[model samples]
Target: MSQHSENTPILEARNLIKVLGGNRVLDSVNLDIGRGRVKVLIGPSGAGKSTLLQCLNFLTPPDSGHILLEGREVNAGSKKELCSFRQQVGMIFQDFNLFDHLSALENVRVALMKVRGMSKLDATERAVAELKRVGLVDRAAHYPANLSGGQKQRVAIARALAMDPKVMLLDEPTSALDPELIGEVLTVIRALAQGGMTMIMATHQISFSASLADEFIFMEKGRIVEHGSPAELLGKGVGSRTQAFCAKISELTGEADGEFRS
Candidate 1:
């Protein structure tokens, strides 16, 4: 088993709650992700997986709860602290939020310059390195409109990686791609996981989650109903609700056995 200390979690959420239109989206949700471990969030639609990720990064601050990064409380109320905190916690969205006008290289470079205050030359070098890491250095000059969905998302990943984030929050990184394109993005993510990058990902790709995650969490009605290793949760030992949900997802994706190549 992977070892982790109880006294410190790389990232943690305590009693996180969010209400939208008087409906509670996150009902006092709590979780802990250890350093260099990958945790995949899986559940039915509208189970608050995305909301939980957003709250963790303060993209959508929770109505109540505390967020701790490296055991230090993240005070969203303080501008300087929040900015620094956000820099250390990178978020990737399903929509591939690349600048329409900027080239892939510039997309990555701009963040390093603006956020980290790196010189233009230094930022460009760092950006090239990151794009290369995502296997998109050749497409450096392509703008978002010119690139395919997979390439665009790769650029987005490069942008986040350029910041040298301590924890990565990916909200369905492969959900927006075509079937053929999904593998390329998943390849990069798998590489990152293998390299021991700490991550919390919300995705419907059950096979990938099962194979790569250190722990799998099943959320429903904004609460974590079950959580365990892939061998336990995806095996015959899970509860009926979780098993039924997994079966349904498999039926929808046509990967009932949950076997997939990254």
Candidate 2:
């Protein structure tokens, strides 16, 4: 993993609250994500992990809160500001989100060309480099329909990386993939973590989370119930609720206790 000074936080959220249809989905959430560190958000379904990420990316503006990227506030109300913030904070969705008609290269290149306003040649070169980084260079010409689920997610990751984002937000990245396919995507993600890319991920892959995450934040009822290193959060001293949650996740993922490996 990339070495980083503990004092510098690349992204921070303060009192982030999001309400949808008269219900609070996120409640006074706060976090400081250090540069080059991997943070794993773990919780039961509908625990607001996805909503918090959406707020961080400005995909769904929070009802009330503030987000800071490299110490500058993200102004969600302004379109230009929101666009710039999004460029710095990339998002990887669960569904892959690749355009069906576009080749993997085009899917990655189009964003570089249109959003970053690069020339087609420049965008193509950058796109290919990102594809190579994600181990998808050989499949650059394949369309979404022609690629496997894992390949498509890698393309999506490549597309995000082409933006040169400071932070990546992944929401249930491997949930939709077949059991066999999940490994490929997880491998790519582990490589990214090892390369020191700052990331916050929500996933059901408890083993991967335990092995790779620098810190774990467990959410419940839209609040962070526990936040600490894997050993602390999964250790014997934690509350029963936290322990039970981790046990359930471990049971489901077939990961033994204290199986962390970086």
In Å, residue 234's CA in model 2 sits off its true spot by 1.0
TM-score of each: 0.95, 0.93
TM-score of 2: 0.93
Name the runs in model 2 displaced over 4 angstroms: 1-6, 237-240, 257-262
Which residue runs does candidate 1 get wrong by more than 4 Å? 1-7, 237-240, 256-262
RMSD (Cα, Å) for all candidates, in order, is 3.0, 3.2
Report, for all candidates in order, the number of backbone clashes.
Answer: 0, 0
Cα RMSD for predicted model 2: 3.2
Top model number, TM-score: 1
